[model samples]
Target: MGEAIHNVIIGNGSAGNGAAITLRERDPDCRITIITMGSLPFYNRYDLPRVFRGCYDWREILVHPLSYYDDHSITLRRNSRVTDVDARSRTITFAHNEVMHYDRLLVCAGGQGYLPEELSDYRGLMSGFGSFEAAMTTYKALPAGGTLVMLGGDMIGLDLARTLIDTGYRVVLLTNEYTFWPHRIAEDERDGFIQALGHMGIEVVDGVHPVAVEEGEAGKPARRVIFDDGGDVQGDVVMPSYGLVPTAEFMLGSGVDIERGLLVDPMLHTTDKNIWAAGDVCQIWSAEDNAYRFYYGWNNVRLMGEMAARNVTGANEAFEGLEDERLRIDKKGHIASPFWEH
Candidate 1:
């Protein structure tokens, strides 16, 4: 009976895809457009490690086939990177200099691998375990039985290590932390994991910080990694697994509140009333912590996207965050925690 609402969502990962579907379900007549920097539509990033290990093909990891977008009547734009956002004018400019107006905007651009200064100049020599393209590039460059120096003890690092080992590559895991998952697992559990990795022929070095990367010959990847303790290791491939940083560069001057991520309320609305944020790119208000914190993992991100969509469509659902019962599977295929609370 009234003018149709135009909803523009950034990113085509789980959060962006979930929000698009939920928005369409809630408001059938509304126009929906999903702009993504990636070339594919809505693929599962969690399967990237599997892609590297040769367990699954890149096409198999796709969450939804292209037909799904057509069936739902959602306009999906690939390779359209958002360059800037004008909150006041309710418009977004892409990397190609194309601009579009939107009635409501949802920023779910997710995150990228955090590259440390030591590895910054050697980006070409380093591979990221965070994205599909990065994983593929690293996998292609790896030679059979070649040594892989993994820098970081994060979940992605562990996953990459497992994949490389299973794929017949020698893996040396370097971590600045005292133990694997020092913050999450018990000391005994950490020790057990270290033993497990050793049994699998993977070397684990703890409390070792990387100082610099010694570049290799022309057309070759970094050959050596130097640590702060004056120790070093040579490898055919270097993979950085230092956590993820929010991909919020476009929101810099958009009048949106961004700390570690785009700050959002319990309802997933940003500082700007018409704009919302969800997934890894958003730091939602946590009642338990009395501050804004990241709610990670696939289940949490999907739920956040749905809730954000509901709020955007005037459903105004109060998000309580992910339930503890939800199972968290790390990149290594291990159930990280609380698969079933007793």
Candidate 2:
């Protein structure tokens, strides 16, 4: 028999894990290695906000335990960051200066939280509500009964705000948009959401932009958010809830096509036949639109990962993307939208 194919997956998020599991089930003899900068094993990122609110601990949110890797014969390398990729050579370099070769590579590095230009320099001062570690940091930094000035008003931000409020932290949410989920919710729904937030004792500010972040005194870190309107809000902990930006910096000059994200065909194959991409780090080619478009949400990402794995394993399956199902959380913290709506 020929040499066993070594599949290297650069991520440990939903997409990466999904791909790994699927690949293992499909090709038992293939070698698989999953790398991640995070120290923890694969966990439910959807429950990260709950982690911040004390609704779930780190162990509780983990999707699979450490033994899952051993049981499946999958190598899981945590705290290892991929620094560069050599597509021509089919090699990837890690932050520790180690290099590894792969017969097939999956770029599921996912996305990083997008901080505004003004707050970029002040990243150390604020907490992020994105990753599991970020949630833990936010939870630890939040003072009892103190104010939390949250930047951004996206769906994730709204959910985080509700969690904080329920956990007894006074929250001040800042958003440049006129309404939450402008592309998804109607104007009346937006107004109702704002009203609901007020009733929950959460402060919501719309149509405002943060121009700068000011450092705090006495080791309190950055506590002030300066607005474009010349107003400011002080908080014990400042958290940013901005959306994600594709984490494909390592693919630069690696022969992988990247525009906002790593470009992938309908089958999720990259320009390099040996390379594939999925999850938030990939932009799928939409045949109908004749352009690359982002497919957000957990279900879409998981499906993309599965498709990428299938294609990598010699299965010719085209990813048509998710249907009209939308997942929305109501004011009561329940999933109001049905699964079929997505």
All candidates' TM-scores?
0.88, 0.89
RMSD of each: 3.8, 3.1
For candidate 2, what is the total of clashing residue pairs?
5
lDDT of 1 at 288: 83
Please list the C-alpha lDDT of all candidates, in the order they appear. 0.79, 0.80
User: Could you tell me which residue pairs clash in candidate 1?
Assistant: none
Worst 10-residue stretch by lDDT in candidate 1? 333-342
Candidate 1 ranges with C-alpha deviation above 4 Å: 1-3, 53-57, 178-201, 216-222, 323-342
Q: Report the error of model 1 at residue 71, Å.
A: 1.0
- Cα lDDT tens digits, model 2, 1-342, are 998899999989889989999999999999999999899899877667776556546788888876899999999999998989998899999899999999999999998877767668888878777778787777877767778887875556666676777778788988655224313566556666566667767787777778777877676634888887898788888877677789999999899899999999999999998999999999999999999987766777888888899999999998986666454547674433332132
Model 1 lDDT per residue over 62-171, tens place = 78776898899899999999999999999999899898999999999998878877668877767666667777877777787888888875665665676777777889
Q: Under the 3 Å rule for N, CA and C atoms, how many clashes does model 1 have?
A: 0
